[model samples]
Target chain A: MKRAFGVMNQHKVMNDQDVRRALARISHEILERNKGTDDLIMVGLYTRGVTIAQRLSENIQKFEGTIVPVESLDISLYRDDVQLRIAQPIKPTTLAADISGMKVVLVDDVLFTGRSIRASMDSLQDFGRAKEIQLAVLVDRGHRELPLRADYVGKNIPTSLEEQVRVRLIETDGTDDVVIVRSGDGNNSNG
Target chain B: MTLLLSGLGMVITLMVDVESNVIGSQNVNAAGTNRKHILDVDVLSEDEILNILDQTDAMSEVLRRDIKKVPALRGRVIVTLFYEASTRTRISFEEAGKILSADVINMSSSGSSVDKGESLLNTGLTLQAMGVDVIVVRHPYSGAPNLLAKHLPKVSIINAGDGLHAHPTQALLDAYTVRSKLGSLKGLKIVIVGDVLHSRVARSAIWAFTKLGAEIVLSGPNTLMPVGLNLVDGRANVLPPVSVQPDLDDAIRGADVVMALRLQNERQNGGYLPSLREYIRRWQITKDRLSSASKEVLVMHPGPMNEGIEISTEVAHGGRSLIEEQVTNGVALRMALLYQVSAGGYQIEEEHPNGQ
Candidate 1:
């Protein structure tokens, strides 16, 4: 509802080079803040979050020569907006390593209203208590509905209410880019 | 959770002194089985079957987790009110309920008040009074689950198996196992051998697989095959394109899956077949007969297998056999069914805009 709606035109904000640089800087910041990767675990949200986590883990491995474990979590059942969807199919949540008493970083592709992160926090309650939990995102689009913030952010983009922020990874979408597509008020999309 | 358990306590207290045979026969309209209760596979649409299979795949993931449990049906109470003795279906339902953190209570007709003349309707009302969320019932009569569902309006009823009528859950797990082994259920030729007439498993399997687009060939003796099941209300009863084949080799040729059902000893005494020896010679599923089928064909059997009668021991315990996997999938399938029925407003139906 912000402006003219164009479905065909997509404004690209980040390319492959920008994504790589952002991930490398985030890895350095994580190591510096945590004072080395001791008892560290990376958990990725399902779909795009998992791919971003693998990229971050690989970057950390290259920088510190330490292999970090990455797990994928599907928070479909924990989402507060489940009643609003057509169907809620709870996907697989594979955690190869237990996160008890460990420093865990939750990763996702795009962070908007932060409801998904909130759902992830609720889901984490059953997987044992983590000593510390942190949030990381590739794109932090402004307009968070929740009182939550990401500790590690790749890009901060200010967006209007009618705009949709989509993060596409090569593994899933066969592309590495972030775009903002404006839509009309006739169509309503969820974050 | 405590409140539900306390309510269960109230149900136990309400049943003080009673004992008699009370499985009264009521006039249940055949069409009454079309309610939300999965009494038989005939009531299910193809989309519903696919949806259940998808949900079963999701439930299977819980088995791989360290917790191995979920709170999807927490605070919900499910009673496995089984009239017949069944170790697999009962234990699997209990396990499924426990994994979903549902308060599960096992009630058998043997030691229960049903032996003391407590009717099915009264027993259902008693459980409904205690706020039971769902009841998984297996009775010796054909439409027993439908009867319980008709009497109890508040609780969901799942038919574990009701006489020769339907075992929808068993059919579901079998479909899941086949979908897991093969990529899809569409256009696959499945040969169901042995007793089809008395098998609730075969009836439900035929209804389920046909809905999922699988071509079914019912292979057995003329006396042992189901009659009057070809059509219902002028439409194909168990879905169309189902053919009846008496020759074992012709029926199994080019088949992707061969399901050998358990041969009932009662069939022999009823004059349906000559003897176990003649039945094995004519219809037993051996590896040699399976040579005409696909090399990667799967062999399945609903358990308590008559090793040498319906299926040879080697084929039942062969590499391509998914009998054990079917049993494992049973727990997960039941978990999905229980979660779908117990969790209010969850998927598996046309969602009401009012969210009832």
Candidate 2:
């Protein structure tokens, strides 16, 4: 029934077990690079990034026996395309603990245009200056408009601008997988 | 000439269809409106009112933060042009614009060119020539903001208060304060005490609260009550049923919220009331009069309160009073309005289909 809608072209790049393995590996990579969560804090972009940050925090607690605090940041108010597009709903950006003198790790589900990360960086400065800032992503699809690269990456999937990479987690989308969707008509009408 | 008129009509219809197609293709935010001015709450739909309230929740969060500022409206210029005297409304608008990082300029009739016999249109043209983004206007005549909105097609106009016509932001903040405390406005009995004829706040509230599914009861002297509130200002929109009770004690019975309107002393010279002492003896919102309502009934007053005349001093500062929070929510509500109107594009310059 689903194939009747021409959805057959979409396929999963990473399954549930593959996603678990990738996240566990990224958890170790974050710990190994930062040398054990001392002044480290995980700041998640809104929606999917928040769930990813919570999973990473839980994995770190399971392995290292210390729970790192996770903060959620909404960057809609800091977007550069305010006039070009429809207004996006502004969500609450809450930071309970100070980010000053701390190693901040920004986490997200996927990195594509890199504009959101630029807005996030601008939003983070208003709270306080961090000692160091690093980027971590579950999937790194390769068209970046800004000069930014993730310090820790789960998977590198190179594709054309017409293709879309969607990461679905059980906490948000009721599944844990990464899928790539390609337009059947080759016109990229939606973009 | 008839042929030419019909030809023009066809062209206008085709243009409207093409414009709608463009908007549909872009998937523009339908939650936002193309309204360039907020002169009154009578024209607002239910969805538009709810959207403003929802956005005010986000703005309130920013107000509670340590920074209390955002760059959402950075570089936008807002000018307050007041022909009437106001302290809270003017300051609230200025602070709201400043919090959104917009530069706010204040101009009053005493200092500006209005004292030198300059008309409102000329002043509006001067501001438009200087490229101001918005003009917050308060005038002593009704429909003053409507005049500015009709003339200044590029700039957004917000009516702070215009005679006895409307004070939309006050009504929005009142709805916000009530909804924040009591959960929902549906089926809530909101009894408005004291003057209803000369109150812009009460006028705006009647439209807003009724549209949100609340039952409104007006209580005051008969001379201070408007004749037909259901068709207020002879506006075409038929409002929900609103009852007017002359006896204050009967109005307070079993009410969920009681909002007291200020009795303007100027109304005395017009023979609207007998005297201040007589008005207070009958209409003042005293403690005994309040206990007739439910124990959980909330009290509100759109200030500069008359302590002994309209409401007692203890009740004004009492636990049930939401006066202070109303001032705070006023800033947030104005921020939401400023951001929405400026971002939601100006009104499309097209005549109505029916040609009213």
Number of the top candidate by TM-score?
2
Location of the lowest summed lDDT over 10 successive residues in candidate 1 chain B: B11-20
Per-residue alpha-carbon lDDT of candidate 2 for residues B171-270, written as tens digits (9 for 90 to 100): 9999989999988899999999878877889988987898788988888777776654332223332334578777777778999999999888688567
lDDT per residue as tens, model 1, A1-191: 33343345557789988888998998888888888899998999987888889998999999999988889998765666432343355567886536779898999888888888987887787788899999989888878899999999999988887787878778988988877777733111233
Over B1-356, each residue of candidate 1 has an lDDT whose tens digit, in order, gives: 23212222111111112111111112111221122456666666677777788888878887766777665666778899998878898999999999977899999998889999999889999999999978999988777777776667677789999887789999999999999999888999999988888898998898789878898888877677666554222223343446777778778899999999988777867887666677788689999999999989999998878898899989999898898999889999988787666543433323211111
Score chain B of each candidate by TM-score. Answer: 0.84, 0.87
Best by DockQ: 2
Residue range with the least summed lDDT across 10 consecutive positions in model 2 chain A: A182-191
Candidate 2 chain B lowest-lDDT run of ten: B9-18
Regions more than 4 Å wrong, model 1: A1-27, A35-39, A58-69, A77-87, A97-102, A109-132, A138-150, A153-191, B1-36, B43-47, B147-151, B230-238, B344-356
Pairs that clash in candidate 2: none
DockQ of each: 0.21, 0.36
What is the fraction of true interface contacts found in candidate 2? 0.27
The TM-score obtained by model 2 is 0.85
